[model samples]
Target: MRAETGTRARRPAGPGLISKVGIILVGIVFFFPFIWMFASSLKPSLEVFSSGGSLLGSRLEWSNYSSVWTAVPFARILVNSFLVAAAGALLAVTVSLLSAYAFSRLQFRYRDRLFLVFLGTLVLPQEVLVIPLYIMASRAQMVDTYAALILPFAFGAFGAFMLRQFLLTLPRDYEEAARIDGAGQLRILVHVIAPLLRAPLAVVGAFLFIEYWNSFLWPLIVINDQDMATLPLGLQMFSGERGTDWGPLMAAATLAVVPSLLIVVAMQKQLANGVNLGGFGGR
Candidate 1:
């Protein structure tokens, strides 16, 4: 009996080791680009192009960072990026939470059908909407303004869907108890449910922030002024009409990526908890 038990334990242990190895391998594969970008940012322009140095061989040339700053209005771009991202995230989360609550807890005629219509928007690519959205923005005289960038993405179907799914998993007991105590819907949502929903809200906010931070397409189309351009658009100017300057380009890329990386690292635990907690409730 003892020998048989040992064999069963050892069999599962073999697969566990294999799974760990596979996960490590995948992580390395995914992280390689960022590693390379950091390394390249440290290399001189000539060294960056040269194939001779080891990935970690070159001494860190910190001057590339200074050169990058001088090469572009990175500070302004950073501010613009921050504003757009922050505003978009705030609006998206606020709207999504309310919408999710309505869909999950409150019932009205054709609610499910309305949700289905909202979800159907997810099927269409953002590219298809760009031209029409741009035209509408032009008509509204919002083309060159921050409103042009922030308003379009303020509410997203994905945010609504994800938050709704998360909200569905929560026990109705808290809401019922709140009502029994004479708490209204808004009061219950603000005092009771919102506090409990923090994990999922954090997850949603983190994702929306990252998405807005990295957005390049719509900003490029609408924002023509240098002062209003986001980091991704400003970085494009560095390429020039001649040839790409790799060192400074890498430097700018590194700077642009830092906020997103930090946000992800900070919220990673919350994101995981949100997803896990959200899994408990059914739609």
Candidate 2:
């Protein structure tokens, strides 16, 4: 009895010294760039490179951030990026929910085949679609518009595939009960299915928002007005004929990362659950 009690009461083993060291090294490797960017943001433009790989400069330059605001119409560009990202995320989620519902629940001929064909689109890179999308947007006269920024890439297969996988894991018992109660497809989707989809929805929304937030090439091709320019395009304002403004550019980049960072942090649990539930882990 004493031996069993002692064994049960013994403290659990913690990570080894080597494991702790490895974790610290891995953390430093992952976090070094952010630390470097923030440190460089406070340095003088010239000192940004001449600081001999040191994190700090000769002195702190708070003006770098103020320069970011005055050097370009940053506030407007920030608003525009936020608007586009939010709109794109909403649209993507709505479309994904509908598509996933149809694919996972509905009985139709060639449905799996059609889904496979749709999933094949995931292999197509954004670069290949840009030309055709640009032409379509041009014909629709959506150039230099928020619609152009948010619409072209909104209907991607990624969200649909993710949501569909999640939906497949869900039992049809609730859906069947809702149907027996005379609830329609859309009603069951909205009232019955959607309430259960919070985690996956949050994951999809966060990813789509980040994708739209960081987009540069498509917006560069489509938007002309500085007023309509997103953060990625706006960041280029730091580079002029005089050469690149490193300090202010770093400041702006840091500022740009905040929104997406907050979203990921806020949705951390949902994102983790969604990933695990989406066919990767057993329920």
Candidate 3:
């Protein structure tokens, strides 16, 4: 017993030197692609994909960013992307929160059947629906407009289902208590439920933002004007029948990656907390 206690007392304290080195190596492994991307963006176009087999080249090309700006409507594309992604995420989260609250809390006729019907929409692929969506947009004269890009994708069945499941994990005590205090449903939802949902909702918003930001096909089919193009659509300018512009393309890609990266970093704490707090649960 004394020997075991002595051994326990003598145990090494913090992470040793080798452990720190191992952590650094692991970090490097994970971040090497990002580092290579930034490095490649700085290289000259010719050196970007050269057989020299190095992450960097002899000459750095500061002009790539300038070239990219002049070569395409990068500013407009960035704005369109920012607007579409931000608005789409906001609208989707709003729809999700409201519908999920209703489905989880309220007593309504055919609620279960209607929810099942709503969930059924998830099985339908976007590709299959785009043709119909396009025809509808044509009828509404919404094609080639921001509404065409943002509105169609704003309300997602997946978001509703996800939020509903998360709501199910929460206890009903607070909601009931609020109801007993002469508060209406909206008041309870806003004051009681929304506070507990901050972490999970942030996580959902981050994911929806990323999804909308990186979207390609729908926007491609919807918008024909160059000025209305998102970053993904703007990528076509970098490629041609003859060849591709590697340096500027890399720079543009790096810029496109930054917003999503910032969103993830900003919401990382909420993401972790939400995941710990039964992020996934449903009856």
Point to the candidate with the largest TM-score: 2
lDDT of 1 by residue, 1-283 (tens): 9999989888988889999999999999999998898888888776777846466536778888998878888888899999999999999999988988888889899999999998898898889989999999999999889999999988778888887887777789988998999999999989998898888889889989999998989999999899899988978977878888777888899999999989888888998898788443546
lDDT for residue 227 in candidate 1, whole number 0-100: 89
Query: How does candidate 2 score on lDDT?
Result: 0.92
Question: At residue 59, what lDDT does model 1 achieve?
Answer: 76
lDDT (0 to 1) per candidate: 0.87, 0.92, 0.88
Residues 43-133 of candidate 3: C-alpha lDDT, one tens digit per residue: 9988887837698788788888888899899999999999999999999888889999988889999999999998898899899989999
Clashing pairs in 1: 169-281
Instruction: Estimate, for each residue in 1-283, the C-alpha lDDT of model 2 and write its tens digit.
Output: 9999887666343346668889999999998999999999999999999989899999999999999999999999999999999999999999999999999899999999999999899999889999999999999999999999998888889999888888888899998999999999999999999999998899889999999999999999999999999999999999999999999999999999999889989889998987877553322
By the TM-score metric, which is better: model 2 or model 3? 2
Residue runs of model 3 more than 4 Å from their true location after superposition: 6-30
Show the colliding residue pairs in model 3. none
Clashes of 1: 1
Counting clashing residue pairs in each candidate, in order, gives 1, 0, 0
Error of 3 at 92 (Å): 0.6
Candidate 3 structure, TM-score to reference? 0.90
Residues forming the 10-long window of minimal summed lDDT in candidate 1: 51-60
